[model samples]
Target: MSKWNPEQDGTLYRMMQEVVASAGGSVRGVLWYQGCSDCNPDEAPTYMSRFRAMVDRWREDCGSERLPFLTVQLNRYTAPNPTPEADACWGAVREQQRRAAREIPHVAVVPALDCPLSDEIHNSPAGNLLIGERLARAALSEVYGRPVHCRAPEIAAARLTSPDPAAAEPTIEPTIELTFDYVAGYLLHTGSLERVFTAEDDAGLIPVKQCEIVGPRTIKLTLTRAVRGESRLHGAYERNPVAHLPLDSDTYMPLLGFYGFPISGAQYDENR
Candidate 1:
């Protein structure tokens, strides 16, 4: 959310209702990746309860008893967490994710314990992207009645080495940018026109607003500028937090909700 505090449970409930109508049986599948925000020993016990509630609501919306739902069992690389409560909570959540797939007919869990974690809470772009795409493929293969091709990422845990092997290295900007790519040209936007962004420097493929590839390589996004009544030239969605407040276009942009921190795909990163 824009801000975090207590009452997150209620917030999740409301969010579930909001998403259930559209994502219920109408959609092919649901990909849920969450729970790090509520890690606790007691929280673990309720993870399944909450997840089950959400799934039930989802199925009800479909007017059916089941929907293809895929989940990600998050990583623990960042935090060598010694806290028992936190570990217990995560264990419970992971169990719920895994069990849902096993117990439910159309559910699945994508493994992510080997990936890098952000401060031990969030997942890295490379890992996050793969999780999403894999979920999509799973749904396409199972629910949508299509034979989907899965591009699994080949990633290995890396240990940085220096002259001393223990010394800290200088800071460098991350060159790896993540986004959705297709083998064809031009993406389509569903709603009102947002500004079009042409990459200036190291900026790579950008997916913003509703406009799919309006230009050959250029992406059209509904611009959201922090400064009121100004156009956004910098196309980086996750560039800065304060940068995306006043959106220039409609709020129904599906890709907008996930602008920057995109799910990693296997095309770019391979172990060949």
Candidate 2:
């Protein structure tokens, strides 16, 4: 998203160059804060390359390839769209930003997906404080190696409870088991555990029969029906996901955004 078109109006870029050239030239890093417009469905597809290119161009202009660059992931919004798929463009942009941070060295992303918005677009003052704290933590950890815990909690492993081969006609379907990394305390739920997560396959969103936290970091999600084929698991992905336990680290930093994990039931891998 931009206030001025770069092709038709080079005014902003020219002004930026002039300012960079005229200043004492002591700039160390760049803080970027523009992408709201790119959340549109028409503009989201090309946002990654465009944003990456701009970062490269800016680095070249500033005479540094390894210059530290920090960016914020798009926060959550309650748009008119009801389905997560239809409302996924903004999330797509955020995913792109996260991917860039992972692929490009010396780059970091501050997640704002959990911040509450005052309006349709802008975050509330409290939300901004959370974002600012996250950004500060990212800078301190990524740039200064201060050992701050900045990463959000992510799914570390998943498993499907296999039905007993010798059992008679079973009354219950199999369940999906998930484990997470960076869990501070025990995983808590806001309401029902079923409200905090989702299970789906090609057939579409499957209703969750039951959800039980097996341990502090492991959870079992039972589906109404068995998965037909390859399926996916998601947590806090909805536009207005059921607020659950405040996932925090031992340092008390809250987990942000949504998380996805694959359940194969064959083995549990911690590398994801």
Candidate 3:
């Protein structure tokens, strides 16, 4: 049994105040490792709002509005659930944490999606080390303004290519070309690249026949057929995703988790 209520009664917040007060009410930054307790279905939905409130309150207490707040996105962990819905709870909380970096300013989320687990709920020492290094790298680049390689590749654009219209029936299969940001070197994969990505439209996940790196930062995904309507490219977006892509730099930082982009409906032309 524990006497301290970290979330319910502001125990951790008060402790933060004590530390800030002892430091004369000013600090350089803050590191947060929380939200695991809130991953339950009953509590996960409110995490983003509650997180925002806590950050705001901490800023007020520490006397800085735009202070850098670095947080660790929860590492992957789950019991074997035969049902897809059983996984949504943790996935929701993880996504909410990821959104904080995008929605808020001067904040960063250290992604840990690729880290191997020691048990059902614990990240191994190596995994923890990787997470820590990522945090430091983010602080250096985002907070200190150093020119460092810390960002994961993000989807920039996707286009659907079809066979020449002059063909009798245009029987050639269509391909989706994907472009990405932060292209310092080639994208690497241990096995088939198709295993790393998914193309989904309203019809659900479209099977990818092949994924070939056409350019240093671009990949061509050959689909089983041409698609219509809006589609999406999800890279490293799975609850558990392939973890290795290191840019050619001083520190070959791996791609962070959960990258996604929309495929515009305009890309598909029936006239083709």
Candidate 4:
């Protein structure tokens, strides 16, 4: 019954067409929530491309070029012992889902990192309700043109703002300032923020000493040491990270999880 897979005889697609025909030969939007099976090393990397292709095919079949597609970002799976590669694949799929929302037109993604799991990979009743509400909000705003606040907070930019360019070494402390978009009011967190944000240089993971909300949409992360080569910043970037994710103070929408965002002023080489 998984919608991600099309039957060999095109049963699922035919079913969709039949449903549309029953509904006066027109459809509103699509709410997609299945991606667990695709969360593997072989499928994660090409998720976005495959997703885009599917969306394109669906829209064409449905006779709409700009159909709204509301996607729920994959929630955490915590039952079976997951390997390092498995964890990475989960993160990769989530990031690709987020990217799909950003790069594809009329596509939107809702955060489910905070949703409770019914089992290893399924959402609990309450979690499903929350996801349903989020999808409805997205459909209203994106498809029906309702004035609703449906977008999740996303990382807009990350800048290396500290180690004060003028200050000498050894005594200097390094910091990276992250700016977020779609934040309703300010950002607030629950547990220790230290475990939520991380950085990676050519040498590997950089220890984050502290994280503080210095501005309405800004989070400043102080690193244990200065980064020399190409680096990237990650927030809640694991399969099930021990995180203190920030939420919008007003709407309480959780910030979208992200990975591998290039940190500006971190000696990043774009060519590489």
Candidate 5:
């Protein structure tokens, strides 16, 4: 989600950085599975590049130089569509993910076809839970020495304040102009209770904000700071069937900034 542009871009990276900083950086892994609704066949192939770009951005933003990325292959049991156009191109999408796993470091793919589902066409209810669990397992496997789970949140519209030229720091204050986009479905903000940051051998997390479905396929969230930081950004959002959709190839593309940073923090934050 973004404020100036609804499309996934650098602005969203800034927001995530702020959330991480406030919650304390050096946090646990990042689980991502957006694509189907966002990426089609023609351009889905580029997801390999986008995924690599996203990995670099995550490392920079979270202040972790080697943060791990866990991804999933496209596996929809639609009984094979007859026509070419009707096909969602799950194969090409899967290939993109496979390529990413092979090309990118700290990258691993979680198999989905093996999982049971009622129907791939509209598998919302049980599918959502399955995705979350699979994400958690993959994350744990990659990070090693700890338990991990999806920090799924409400898909909130992106909101931002007018750029304050006078201010030196990036603008984090609330704004009236909110850019609406696909907010997530499962997890909202981290949570009320603060948990120990010792979940991962060397990871930290904290629940900071939450969001819900507000429009056709978007969500909005109000962010708060999570100081203590948990091992997993611990918190469970009220269940929603269609909370997270497969992202587009562009979803992982980084919107670089003036000096090549989508987000600007103190030099101290950089080494933290």
Candidate 6:
């Protein structure tokens, strides 16, 4: 079964059809966890569109328009010393997976970044157990209409806050307040918060001076310098980011990694 091509005649789709025919004509839902192979320069950019098309075809073949799909976000891939381009590809695919979950109907994505990797790219047995529990929770809640908290926390908004609103001059140090959604309770981080959050402008990556949980669902990030132009906030976006990541205090569900969340209130600097 090729990961890049869903149009092949004798592949996973055909095999799935055979299985469904042998058993029953219908299935409860589809659990998809295959995206590592698509993490490449050639495939990563088009991953979301292709995936959406594949889902449409699956629903058509399965005779259900609103068929539920539970997908797993790409986990850590720590082989040898990977190149920068490879890391970018992996992160692109992950961000695309997140987009699919938000854009598509009846589709949900579960985080696997906290899960342990058995090999270079595959999840460990113990990690698989955790993923299985997460998948079951999503299926029960989304498909069976059961009351279960399955959705992982996601970045809602990132806005600039004045360090001192009453100051006469514009403050050089800008504070960004990041708000999250789907959090069951307060947000908590396990390791250094600096490694988990970053900001980027036209120049490059900006150093985060300080990070603190200012509120139940909010995190305040202090930037070293003022934003030059349009800036973006990234969290847990590296190929193999920190193992101890930010998670929900109540459900312990890890927050999903995001790529280019626009930081509002950035000063437009033409001469950067």
> Best by lDDT, which number?
6
Best candidate per TM-score, number? 6
TM-score of each: 0.45, 0.77, 0.77, 0.89, 0.43, 0.92
lDDT of 6 by residue, 107-129 (tens): 99999998987888889999999
Per-residue C-alpha lDDT of model 5 across residues 247-266, encoded as one tens digit per residue: 21222111000000011121
RMSD of 1: 17.1
lDDT score of residue 30 within candidate 1: 66
lDDT, residue 43, candidate 2: 81
TM match of model 5 to true structure: 0.43
lDDT (C-alpha, whole model) for all candidates: 0.42, 0.66, 0.66, 0.82, 0.40, 0.84
Q: Which candidate would rank higher by TM-score, 1 or 4?
A: 4
Q: What would the per-residue lDDT of candidate 3 be over residues 61-143, giving only the tens digit for each residue?
A: 66889989888777666555424343445556666777788798888876676677898778899988888888898899889
Report the lDDT of model 2 for residue 169.
Answer: 79
RMSD of candidate 3 to the truth, in angstroms, is 4.2
Query: Compared with the true structure, what per-residue lDDT tens digits does model 2 show for residues 165-190?
Result: 57887544767888877675666554
Candidate 1 lDDT, 109-170, residue by residue in tens: 65554344455456778867756666777677667768564322111111111122243872
Enumerate residue pairs that collide in model 2: none
Clashes of each: 10, 0, 0, 0, 25, 0
Select the stronger candidate by TM-score from 2 and 6.
6
Q: What clash count does candidate 4 reach?
A: 0
